[model samples]
Target chain A: MRDSRGMRAFFQVGGIVFALALTTVVLVASKAPPFAAYLNIALGAFGSWEVFSNVLVSWVPLLLATSGLLLTFTVGLWNIGIEGQITFGAIFATWAMRSLQGGGTDPAFVIMLSILAGALGGILWAMLAGALKTFGGVNEIFGGLGLNFVATAVNLWLIFGPWKRPGIASMSGTVPFDKALWLPTLTAQSRLSPSSIAIAVAGIVLVYVLISGTHFGLRLKAVGRNPRAAYLLGIPTWQYMMTSFAICGAFAGLAGAIQVTAVYHRLIPSISSGYGYLGMMVAMLVNYRAALAAPVALFFAALNVGSIQLPIVLKLDSSLAGVLQGTLVLFVLLAQGAREFFARKGGKR
Target chain B: MRKINRFILVLFLAAVSTVAFGQSSNFTFGLLMVGPYNDHGWSQANYDATQYVVAKTPGTQMIYLDKVNPADRPGTTASQLAESLVAKGAKLVIFSSDDMSDEAVKFAQAHPDIFVIMSSGDQVWKDGKNAKNIPNMVNIMGRMEYGKMIAGVAAAITTQTGQIAYLGPLANDETRRLASSVYLGAKYAWTKYLNRDISKLKFKVTWIGYWFNIPGVTSDPTQVADDFFNSGYDVVVSGIDTTEAVTEAVKYAAQGKRVWAIPYDYVDAIKEGNAVSLGVPYFNWGPAYVSAIKSAMTGKWTSHFEWNGPDWKNINNPDTSAVGFNRGSVLSKPAAAGVDKFIAELSKGLNLWKGPIVLQDGTTYLKDGVAATDQQIWYLPQLLQGIEGQSVSK
Candidate 1:
């Protein structure tokens, strides 16, 4: 049984490699040399220690968002509004910073409080969706998506209305916070802050342990498989679902807080970035496996950091990175389907 | 879920189709945009000019990256994109739009070997906010103030109810100056030519606070245009990047509302507005870009700030003009003739900068009879006094 399972995993990996190789061939024949472009991507992403450090900066948010998504996915919940949760997190964090702007409080203490505020913001948004799903009989997807719009409106309103700069209003975003209020960067050059990356790693570890080792994880899985059966077994399915959303939202919010404090050093309209959406993609690509989310999130982040070379060297759109990632997921799913079909056919024979 | 899957498929194909084959060349140039390449307004105009420059000048290869703004790319940055472009062998790079000022400054400082040109950038302007004349970077902008003035005149002449609207984009000095120029032209013609009171002209501005529309982040220009027409404003002069004003006006006209719009940036924008388009005040960046590319090719590239004006003889000439006002087919004969008359006066140096100019805060900007200098025009602090709208969000 072990040998058979190993063979299946190897085939699955081989199929993905084959699909990617085919895409590279197609790219080279029609337009750019995929080999040279791929080389550029590697050199840009990981050529030097400094460049790799920048990759980790992007990876932090991707990892955090994916961690939250992995939890919801485990419970068979599609929390599409993680994007809104992220925005609320950043907005809440910004509120804390702006509120404490002139205070003589310790910088480190303020940062901690701000991050906590961000978490509270994320939890509040997530709870709304959870309540809607549980009490109002609404789908999490619709609730989350609607909340995303509201969050975006709130962000824009803050920037263009109440939180607008003193002398001028611009799409350039609100005035950057003071340098002293900034999240401590790992170095003067890269945007990476060591604390944010540490939080992301801790999030990954927590997710791995929670999903694989605990009885709570087993119960969540049972509820996902059949809520009626889990209910018959005395499991409070609704509570599990709500807990999953709350936990997921907190992680996403932490990522958003880091975004405001570290990335731009100010709340811009795009403070949420696309990390929430990208994290959803990462979760789906990994088939909602928390254990697989870490490496995959890093890979996605690296692809984005590296594909800047597409437009530079080949006159190609940098969105090629997204295309490759999507193709990988599609091919992996197809291969998995094929394997299941063959196994059933062989068993019947 | 199915819709999202389809959207991803379409995005993938779109990305594939945008791939331009790299060609061997003696000179290569990079153009960056903060929005889509075919946005039909600001970025499209630059994209067309870049193609024109590359095709007209042989031995030159061109690579351009659109949607380079941080808002567009979540994981990367504009400066990083610029670095990759330079690494790709772009001898000269043009960072278009005002938002890229910080990115351009940082990139230019780091890469002294590469020449940088910032379009509509205030960084190199002598009196502009955050002004800095970096050795390798040049700032180039069209004399769009005159074009906007002509657009304003057209609106003022065309309005039946004396209610003209200015659909503005953001509150930067560039956008502020552009929007205010419309008010100036409308007031100038309404009082001097139409024998009407300036205040009665109802020249109001509604700022959308961005070059192009980003859903939820900026007020939708289409909605703003609809609101203007619904509230008695019959002529809308676009100061934003997109052709939403023209499109919205065309829709209102079909529904029996007699509304007109004048688009900004592209001369051909009138095509979308059809019967509702009065005209468009456009920037012809070809003349400027071609010269910059030529200078770089000849090893004579040096940073110089150029604020170019329209060719007086033929402002709409496809070849050598910095700015042009293209009159739409819907313009009446009298209005068209009046537009011509206005242009004629401008050709003989009709300076709108003459004093008696008051600021929005009721501060006197230019004393009577004193013409405004380039420095004064380049760094307008607020909307001119008579314009209706908030200069700052507060």
Candidate 2:
């Protein structure tokens, strides 16, 4: 067991080294100074208090999305519809804020209510996917993918149709809400909201504790490992799966709500900003271990924020960050597979 | 030892102050383009204008990041990106798209010391409806109405089939007025120049919902252009920021069809369509951008809105004109003469926006002989009558 554990660590380190080397080759091929590109990304992310705060602002939603995905992954379910769920949450939050903005309601109360509405919106959408999987005999992956497209369509329709700015229908998005409707931030100019950071940290902690230290978590693992066996043991398989979907959806909804109130302050067409998909990547990179999810999500967020410097400084496309991220995840997964293959071969010999 | 240390400290202070003084004279302006810098349309015009400014001003340098829209640069707002530019020693930043109005306002308000140039925005215009009191921000837009009018005359005279279609960007006040200006010019040429019946000319506009194509989010301009040609509309005027209309027209022309396109925004857009092109109404942003950057450099910057029009003496002059129309290669001699005559008439104060104008809903927009004010034209509430397209975004 000790030797195998050592081997796992060795392969994981090897995977990271390989990812860096591959990224270096790409930088060299693009004729960019590889060391400078890496340094720029590092400086862009943590060079100052302001840019670092921006990283935290990005980290909030990403961590929330990863925390949510951890629950669905724990249940052996691939909730690709989290993207749609996030979009629905943003829509619902925007709807609530728009309805309450001029209604003489307390601003704080309205923001809270809107966030709650977002959560409910996410639950409803996720339930539809859950229902499709549990009762309609459709696979979750396909159902989730279909729902994501539907969510995007609905978002575009609202932005271009009923919710469009008066006398304007452009992809710039709906009219921004008043300053009173914006979430309280750490500074007048910064997008970082302490409340949002606290909520995201709390969310990951709740997920970690739930997955590790509770009866529901143990039963969830049983359901994930073998639903038929779990059902025979009276674990109530479908219920656990649905419950996991709902919880994940709630977290995704909060992420969307934060995006509206704390970040954009309007219903932009790409409001979710691909955080739902990025979170899935973060979960996979961490192998769905809840404890390591926050740090990894932060690293991903830093990569995103830092890459903006590539275009500004090096004249390189910022999508190089995506390449690095894809390679890192691919190599880690490949390393794990290889380790298992070698172990099985040795045992057979 | 103490005296030697004091001398070293004084030397260090002198070196730092000299560096700071040297940096103050060297002006760096950052630009955020809504599309690729070399897109051959709106973004390219602004990019080239910045390059022009660098050439005209001795100490000026430009730093730019294109594709600044939300879809392309996910997780970063235009304001946040501007801050990054500021960190890289930019004292002034130009947000060069109307799509970035909100973020531009946010950035200007956040960094009052940083000069901001918001092209194609009216937020700083004191008389504008959406005006804000942003002291450090200036709004600049060219009077492309005149250019579009000239494009209309060229199309009016060149079309073998009297049907003209407009490939509109999105439903907005700016787009509506521009599309309406095309109609007004076309009507003037069709009746007054060609001596044709008004009812015989067909003018239609189809909005693709953005300044340029974004795959699933907008109607494909290539498909829309084909639809226009397939349905027998012989002249298609493109208002989007890309060359799709001309590219598609080239395709249809290759098939032995008599199709022509009028592309908008950049000066060389006619070159893109070559023989099938029927002139382009382009913004010459160099003079305006040079003046704006110089003002910012010399500390003469003050918030204002400029709606500069063409330099009629030489409309195609790169140094003086704010807006100009370049006739395409395939324009017949007679059609080119008609376009020149139309410009002469415009220079002589002939206003087509005058009077008896009606909305698409049959409501009167202007009474008889009543001319439109800048405000009236800028805030056009709906598509004008005789244009078959959505008046408002329902």
Candidate 3:
């Protein structure tokens, strides 16, 4: 067991080294100073208090999405429709705020109710994907993918149609909410909201405790390992899967809610900002371990916030961040596969 | 002891160099473009204007990040990106798109010390509808109405089928007014220049819902241009920021369709359409940008709105004009002469926006013989009576 543990650490470190080497090659091919580029990303992310705050602002949504994805991954389900779930959450949050604003309700209470509505919206959308997978024999991957397109279409329709700004039909999105409806931030100018960070941290801790320290978590692991055996063992398989989906959806909805109430303060067309997809990557990179989710998601968010400097300082495309992220995930998965392959060979011998 | 002494010496030298270099008088301005810098349209015009500033002004440099829209730069806002530019030592930041109006206002409010120029926005105009008293923000826009009018005259003279199409961007006060300006120019050219019957002229507008194409969101501009040319409209005047109309017209003309296109927003746009091009009505942002940057540098930055018009003395003068029109190669000899004559009339104070104009909903926009005020033209509420399009966003 000790040897195997050592081997796992060796392989993980090896994966990281390989990813770095490959990224270096890419930088060299592009004729950029690799060290300078890396330095720029680091500085862009943590160079100053203002940019670091921006990283935290990005981290809340990403961490929330990853925490939710962890639940789905634990149940052996791919919630690819998390993007749609996030979009629907923002849409519902926008709807709640629009419906309740200036209607004589306390703004704080309206914000709370809107966030709850966002969670409900995500729950409904996720349940649709879960139901499609369970009842209609459709795969969750395809169902979720189809739902993402529908969600985007719905978002575009609202932005350009009924909810459009008066006398304007552009993709600039709905009019911003009143300042009174905004989530209180660390500063008047900063988008970082303490309440949002608290919510995200609470969400991940809840997910961690639920996934690691409960009988329900064991049953979820069993369902994930083998649904048929779990079913025979009297664990309600489809119900567990649907419950996991609902839990993940709630987390995603909260992320969307924070985005509306704190970050953008309005529903733009790209409100989801691809956090659902990025969260999936973070979950995969951490092997779905909830403990590592926060740090890894923060790292990814740093990469995103940092890469903006590539264009401004280095004249390089910011998509290099995506390239690094893709290679890191790819190398780690390859290392895992290699480890498993070698272990199987040893057992046969 | 020796190593510590050397480290202290190095640190002292670094501090001295930092202070020395910081004392040099250098002005760094930042630009945030809504589209690709090389798009050869609205964004490119602004990018070139900054380049001009860098060239003409001593001790000045520019740093810019193009494609600053949310779709392109995911997980970021325009104001947040402006802060990044500020981190790079930019004292003044230019938000170079109408779409960035909200974020520009936010950035200006947040950074009261940083001078901000929000191009094509009326937020700083005290008399404008959405006016805000942003003390550090200035609004600058070219009067593209006259350029569009020239494009209309070019289309009116070149169209053999008597039907013209206006490829519109989005429905707003700005777009409505610009589209209406085109119709007014076309009507004048059709009746006065060609001596044609008023009943024979047909001007229609088809808005693609955006300034440029976003697949699955906006209607395909190429398809819209094809629809116009495939039908009987011989000339398609583009109001969007890209050159799809000119490209499509070139495609149609290559197949012996005899279609022509008048592209907007870029001076060299006719080079794309070649013989099928009717001309381009482009904005020249250099003169205004240079002055704005100079003001910011000299601590003379005062917040105001400027709706700059073309230099009538030399409309296409790169250093002086805010707007100009370049005639294309496809225009016939007489048609080219007519465009020149129309320009001369405009230079001699002929007002196309004068008198007797009716709204699409049959309300009088301007009474008989009454010229429009700047506010009336800027805040035009609907398309004119003779134009065919939705005047308001539904």
Candidate 4:
């Protein structure tokens, strides 16, 4: 036990050091100024109120996706299908927006309907993985991956064949959603909004409560820690697992809807903006705690926001933040395992 | 244990030595690319041309970043790269993409003393707009639409159904006008030359929302092309980046049937997929880039919107563009001869906008014998006659 603990500590320290070394290697290999890039990231991400708003804009989707992931994570499920779920959410929102076009529909109703559609879209997608795991014995990771490809194909068919914008597919995205339906902007020019902030905060609180403050949370933890034990205790393990996935899927969907309603004002091809995977990173970095997720997500958001400045200030690649963030996460993982190693080493010594 | 320590020491030294050697300055000119230098479309061609220029010029070196997504590094702009290059003592710095527009402007604004060249920018024009041109900045773009029209002619001639589809990256005015010019060229080929009714020649256009494929979110031009070909359209034109159009056509070709494709901005795109390609409208960004850098070096850098293309006197002539066509595509003998005649007429100033032009919605764009101004052409938001599509007001 002492040897194993020592090895764990060694791993913890080694992982952090290795990640930092890897980051340095990346910077040197790319011939970029790592220090300047880091400085730019800091300034761009958190240097001012205006920049903080940019961080918030990036954080909204991240927090939402991560909060959803917290549910599945609590139950020991890895729902890698968040990206596809987000895409489906955006697609569903687009369909709702299209139907309401020229109907002079109430903007609030449109927003609510779109969000509902997104949740439904995500839940439906997650059900596929859930069914496969519960019935067919297929792995969720591979199932989610396959479903992602299918969602992409379906999105393509809808946009190209039936829903292609009037003349050409534009980089600007679906003919901008009706101005009336747009999520109210913070300023006339900025996409950041008060409602988005509220939504992000609420998503964190709600997920925290559902995952940690309720019996469901206890059941989830039990199921995750030992599914067979939970099943023996008369708990329906499959139901809880599937519900966790469905809940996670819904959160991811809400993220997509918020992206459309708030940031983009219309569905663009890449509106998900890799937020799903980034959210996964956020979830893991925070050790899957709903309470810890918001600040961590904000940290990552700041990194993303800061990266935009590097291109302007340093002409460095924006991926520098990715390198740094990857390093930080790797370090965090190392730090978590260090205590075990120290105790074991003390015993051995 | 002693041998292991020696081996480790030797390995560490080797790594350090190798890295030191890798930073050696061999070439003088440095290229700061915004995206991957090997995307096989926009940035790749620019990278290729830089290598070509370096190879031909001799004693010149080129360094670039390939597959550098905008999100890769935060808070950095093209100007920062320019400054970094300047600090490294590079003689010239070239900003490769238009997304670098704001960054380039900021960099040029800050570093007025440094030599800067921005590709596909309009800031170089408009007196007092640019700080780089206060002494050392120049802009380079292409008459991409000129080659696009040539590809259009090929599409019109090669199409078995006389129906052609232009897949664009955006619905912006630049994309719109190019698509319009292509249709105009096709219409000229089909009606005036082939003696077919203009109404019978079907043309449709769709944009691929952004510049690249966004996995799981929307339709890609490659998939869009597949849909178009499946819908009985024969000739496909792409106004987006990548060899997606050519690649998609090649897939269709493997079934022993041909669906001709016209590609934009790179000549090598046609070479990428041999089956259904009908050449490409290439951008010769090198000449303009060279001229800009030279101007900056000699202190003659001045801002002007330069739109130069094949000397037309010998368009098939390879003297001018780093962005022109390859030789001997599979146009019919008659079509080939017609193209030659058309080139001559173009050289003599055949305006595609010689109108009585009407938009798809039947709005009069220009009266007969009237030539639209560059601004008018550049900002054209509507489809021309023979295009069956709508422009949404939202």
> What ranges in model 3 sit over 4 Å off?
A1-3, B1-25
Candidate 4 lDDT tens digits, A103-131: 87788888889888987888888888888
C-alpha RMSD over true interface residues, each candidate:
6.4, 6.1, 4.8, 9.2
Candidate 4 lDDT score at position B162: 74
Each candidate's B-chain TM-score, in sequence, is 0.92, 0.94, 0.93, 0.86
lDDT of 1 by residue, B138-187 (tens): 88999999999998888898999889888988876777888889888888
User: Over 4 Å off in model 4, which ranges?
Assistant: A1-4, A10-72, A75-275, A281-349, B1-36, B52-61, B68-95, B99-116, B123-139, B316-319, B390-394
Tell me the docking grade of candidate 2: acceptable
The number of residue pairs in model 1 that clash at the backbone is: 1
Kindly list the per-residue Cα lDDT of model 2 for residues B30-117, writing each as its tens digit. Answer: 9999999989999999999999999998898778889998778777899999998888789999999998999999999989999999
lDDT, candidate 1, A58-132, per-residue tens: 999889999998888888899999999999999999999999977998888888888989888998899999999
Q: Which residue pairs does candidate 2 place in steric collision?
A: none
Clashes of each: 1, 0, 0, 40
TM-score of each: 0.85, 0.95, 0.94, 0.65
- For candidate 3, lDDT tens digit of each residue in A48-87? 8889999999999999999999999999999999999998
List, residue by residue over A1-349, the lDDT tens digit for candidate 2.
2238889889888888899899999999999766667777888899899999999999998998899899899889999999999999999999999999989999999999999988887888899999999999899999999998899899989998899987788688889999998999987877889999999999999999999999998888989889999999999999999999999999999998989998889988888788988999899999999999999999999999998888777788888899899899989999888888888887877
Model 2's alpha-carbon lDDT is 0.90
How well does candidate 4 match the true structure, expressed as C-alpha RMSD? 8.7
- Per-residue lDDT value at B17 in model 1: 36
Which 10 consecutive residues of model 1 chain B have the lowest summed lDDT? B15-24
Worst 10 residues of 4 chain A by lDDT: A167-176
